[model samples]
Target: MIRVLIADDQELIRQSLSFVLDAQADITMVGTASNGREAIELVRKEKPDVVLMDIRMPEVDGVECTRLIKAAHPQIKVIILTTFDDDEYVFGALRYGASGYLLKGVSVSELANAVREVVRGGSIIMPGVASKALEMFARMARGSMQIAVDTQQTASLQENEWRVIREVGCGKSNKEIAAALCLSEGTVRNYLSSVLSKLDLRDRTQLAIWAVQTGVTADPYGDRT
Candidate 1:
């Protein structure tokens, strides 16, 4: 079973999510917290497989709590389930290793699947938020954003890998990338894993960030070197 913790300042949200998620046979609610501090504390005690976090909680905010949680327990996955879609919150949580960023508007089923997805080492982003993130990255790329990794590593990437990166930068999921590239989902996942290892990135979120920041998404197929 995928153990989950719900962290939200509102009692209703915390209890509601816990009730719905706990009903899933594959998921169990390990605990709930009303603030970031309590969330962090419960995380240490529960060591849940996934955390459904709210962004605007008092005391520590979800973004910082995610950082602390990941820093202390990298094995635990965090999904920022918030009403806020602001760029600051989106990128902040992602940069700190949040496995998913979903708006509270999502259905209970979508949220439940997201929890399972993250537990399987996949990243999830709401469609609207994904577009915003891509646009923000593109804007940043036009100014001063650049990939900090070694050029040789990037140049060593295969053409198919670049295709996968481009699709990811466009905010496509593995299933979408597979269909676009005419490959199976497993192949897309393999490419993602390969790219992550090649670039020394932590996850697909960082890979997408790197793709946009490096302008890979802007160009068509061509020699990157």
Candidate 2:
């Protein structure tokens, strides 16, 4: 079963979400918290597989909570569930290791699916948030992408490497990439490692961001922002 912890300041949201999530046979409600501080405490003790985080909480916020939780336990996945879709909140939460962002009012079925997908290392962004996120990314890259390109180096990628990078741009996990490319997961990891080395990137997150910025994915609409 997928163990989940709900962290929302609103008691009604907390109870309602818990009721829905717990009803899923494949999931278990590990615990619930009313604030970021309490969420951190529950996380340390319960060690749930996934955390449903709220962006606006008293004393501490979801972004900081995600950072702290991921720092201490990177294996635990966090999906921010909030009413606010502000660019800063979304960007900051993901920058600090949030696996996904789901705007409030999303269907419980989709939210459950998101929790399952994230546990498998797949990142999911709500469609509306995704559009705004694209705009945010394009805007942020406009002035800085050229500098990154210059600093990275004169690097060339193989066809297979390009395939992996493109999938990374789409936020596909290694398992998904392997399935898509008809390659073994081990091979996918090696390809990603090679891409990171050639590009002087630290991890897949950087690779994904860079791929989008450099248009390596060859996405015609990436510049729409």
Candidate 3:
């Protein structure tokens, strides 16, 4: 079963999420926390497969909590759930290695599916949130946001690896990329893993941001793009 922890300041929300998730046989509600501090403690103790995190909390916010969790236990996947989809928080969550961003208003089934997706080593964003996230990224590129990685380091990627990076920037899932490139999902996963290793990226979100920052997807259907 997919182990999950819910962290929300509102008791009602926590209870509601638990009620919805408990109905799924594939998922187990391992624990719940009322604040980021409690969530961090529970995370260290329980080591759940996925964490449904809230952005606002009393002791600590979700962004910092995510950073701590990933730094201490990179294996644990975090999905930021919040009512607000502010650009700073979205970018902050991704930068801190959150597996996904989701609105609390998303259906219970969608939330469960998102948790599964994150557990399976896939990144997800609520439908509308993703478009806005991409738009924020575009603005960052156009503005003065510094590219986080060393360009010289990424200069070693082969043509095919660059292609993989571009595809990731477009937010195509592994299965979609496989079908589009006429490759097996396993092959696509392998290629992406290799790309991440070579480029020293933490996750797909970083890879996608880097691709856009480098303008790798600017040219449609181009080899490097």
Candidate 4:
């Protein structure tokens, strides 16, 4: 089961989220917190697989909480939950190691799926948030492309690994890649692990950004495969 900790200041929001998430047989709500500090304490104790973080809260905010949580426990995935689409909060959370972001209005199914996706090392942005994220990415790309490219790391990827990187860059899930390549999901996951190791990437999101920055996404996955 996927263990989760819900961190939201509003009692109602916390309870509602817990109710929906707990109903999933594959998920368990291990704890809840009304603030970032409390959330941090709960996390250190529970060691949940995922954290549903609220952006705004009393005392420490979600951005700082995310930074702290990731610094100490890098294995726990954080998915920011917020009613606001504040670009500052979104960028800050991502920079600090949030794996996904979802608006409070998102469907229960979508929220649950986001948690699962992040746990699997895949990132998700709510449908409406995607366009904004893309815009932010485009703005960041201006500076990112100008930065020195690490060719040595680029040279380490094999042809099949490059294909896996491209699929991930296209936002295809592991199962989708497995189906398309006639490989098992475990095999696809192994390919991803190898790709990350060879490329010296932090995670799939970093890999996707590097792939786009390095202009590796221009080629089709089939050709690369």
lDDT of 1: 0.83
For candidate 3, the 10 contiguous residues with the lowest summed lDDT are: 216-225
> Pick by TM-score: which candidate is best?
1
- Between candidates 1 and 2, which one is better according to TM-score? 1
- Cα lDDT listed for each candidate: 0.83, 0.77, 0.80, 0.79
By lDDT, the candidates rank as 1, 3, 4, 2
Please list all clashing residue pairs in model 3, or write none if there are none.
none
Model 2 misplacement above 4 A = 139-161, 167-205, 219-225
* Poorly placed runs, candidate 3 (over 4 Å): 139-160, 182-184
C-alpha displacement of 50 in model 4, angstroms? 0.5
What is the per-residue lDDT of model 1 for residues 1-225, given as tens digits with 9 covering 90 to 100?
999999999998888898899999999999999999999999999999999999889999998999999999999999987665456786678777888688886898889989987887788877767777676557655555455778878877898998988988888877788888899988888888888888888887777778887777887852264
- Per candidate, the number of residue pairs that clash is 0, 0, 0, 0
Worst 10 residues of 2 by lDDT: 145-154
> What is the per-residue lDDT of model 2 for residues 96-182, given as tens digits with 9 covering 90 to 100?
678767888789898898888777556667666655656545554564433254443534667788888777776666767789889
Instruction: Give the lDDT of residue 56 in candidate 2.
Output: 86
> If both were scored by TM-score, which would come out higher, candidate 1 or candidate 4?
1
